[model samples]
Target: MSRHIQDRIGRRLSTVFPCPDAVEDTSRLGQVLLRLAQALAPAPAGNPVPDSFRTDLLAAVPQLRRYALAQCRNAAEADDLVQTTLMRAWENRSRFEPGTRLIAWLFTILRNAFLNQRKRLRREVEDVDGAFAATLSLEPEQERRVELIQLQAALNTLTAEHRETLLLVMVDGLLYEEAARVLGCRTGTVKSRVSRARERLALALGTD
Candidate 1:
């Protein structure tokens, strides 16, 4: 190894990669370090379907729905997209890089499926003057439903990129790096989109 490379490593100044299953602190700096390590590590080759794959996938359904609704704005269409994504992910299990984050993988599949279907079907639904809010629900069932309507409308006004970014980072709690992976974009792009989305939503809802 060159002395320059060794010096970089000794100082921990080299770039770090991200890995799916590496659990670390929630802080942004911590995530950055973890991702750096992940990036340096070789990808797990082949598909050794983990025992939790099915269960984990099932668990991710609600998140998938939230993302889908934000993307397509219709409840039924969101459900269909989730279904299609799950089906495709399952069918392509062998292609999945092992030891990676399942949700990110599934999300990538869902996103691609959504984009492809949008191209073919171009199906549009009435957003009820409000797109569904991923975070809606406060009081009584009926009242919550009403609030959700308004939230949905506000959500619909956002650009698709903003909506998807908010859903991934805010709703799903994915780190920016993880979100970038799922969205097939850079971490900087994910961060920017989330910032813009939050500002727009705050303006729309008049929240602090």
Candidate 2:
């Protein structure tokens, strides 16, 4: 097997067979191999499936729900989106590569599912004055409002690429490298886009 596959198998093994603490004579490598065999062994008769397989999905549900709610105007729709995302992830669990960041993978799945749903519902008219719009709050100060309005307008004017990068970095608190990974771009591209976006925002706010 390739080294990458071996490494992945090794990691999965470690999670399954942690070394005993009291044994002084057991070599670390031996413990690792033992763990690997145990993890790869056929399931015992009547034994339930491992819970670790669902660890990523369980951990990500709250975050996924929050993200969905933010993207969808309706709470009911957001719940449906989360449920769909979970179901899709569960069905595709076997395709997930070991040792990858499962949460990131789940997020990607949720994002794609949401975008697809959005495309399907594109013909629906949005409410301009309902709870969705009212959920948006303005800044307390008049100056802050003006600044925020200017920033919001500038954001609306930006290309989707620029806006997404900026929002992912600033609003979502993703590091530039992580943001680039999500965007499927190079780190340098993320940096450049972020820098340009800041400059554009500053100019739009008349602070440049």
Candidate 3:
């Protein structure tokens, strides 16, 4: 990567992984970083995936993982979703417009893959009883852990539209116009959904 492109990727990564306690944070951001390093390992010779594509994908990983985790609420499954998204993006990379927001395009792909997966598994029973949560080892900071749990639970209560909109606009830092493009809606609609999602989240967290 050129120095300018490297700097740009660094900027995006900082935005996505801004937490000083990211390694110790209970939100699984650390896992995303680890997987990112693994994911960017050099593609084998004869592999058609372009280097620029790989660079852009690397920059998008943090946002993609964060969005996936919010959608699925399972770290492992969310990682799988991101992997699937990357594969699809690589396969169809020729269709992507140059100079556009690559993260937004990847988000659209990830969201579609997740929705398809949900449809396929609609009849199956998920971990509805917090079994996975029970297995996670919490840190020594009880208050912060409890707060994160509370926030995650609040996020879970949001409708799918609200949650998707909130994460795309609020968490992922997409412009309303870009978010609307990802969500297949008008800009005004994106703004409305984000407003309602914020209201709902605040109400759920008792911050309103």
Q: Which lDDT tens digits does candidate 1 get at residues 51-170?
A: 566557656766676666656766667667776776677667678786778888888888888878867977653442432233343345775445445445556676767766766776
> What is the alpha-carbon lDDT for the whole of candidate 1?
0.60
Give the number of colliding residue pairs in candidate 3: 0
lDDT scores for all predictions?
Answer: 0.60, 0.57, 0.66
Clashes of 2: 0
TM for every model, in the order presented, reads 0.61, 0.54, 0.62
**Residue 131 CA error for candidate 3 (Å)?**
9.1
lDDT for model 3, please. Answer: 0.66
As for lDDT, the candidate ahead, 1 or 2, is: 1
| Residue-level error in angstroms, candidate 1, position 153 | 6.2
Candidate 3 has which clashing residue pairs, if any? none
RMSD of each: 14.9, 16.0, 9.3
Pairs in steric clash, model 2: none
Cα error of candidate 3 at position 79, Å: 1.8
- For all candidates, the clash counts are 13, 0, 0
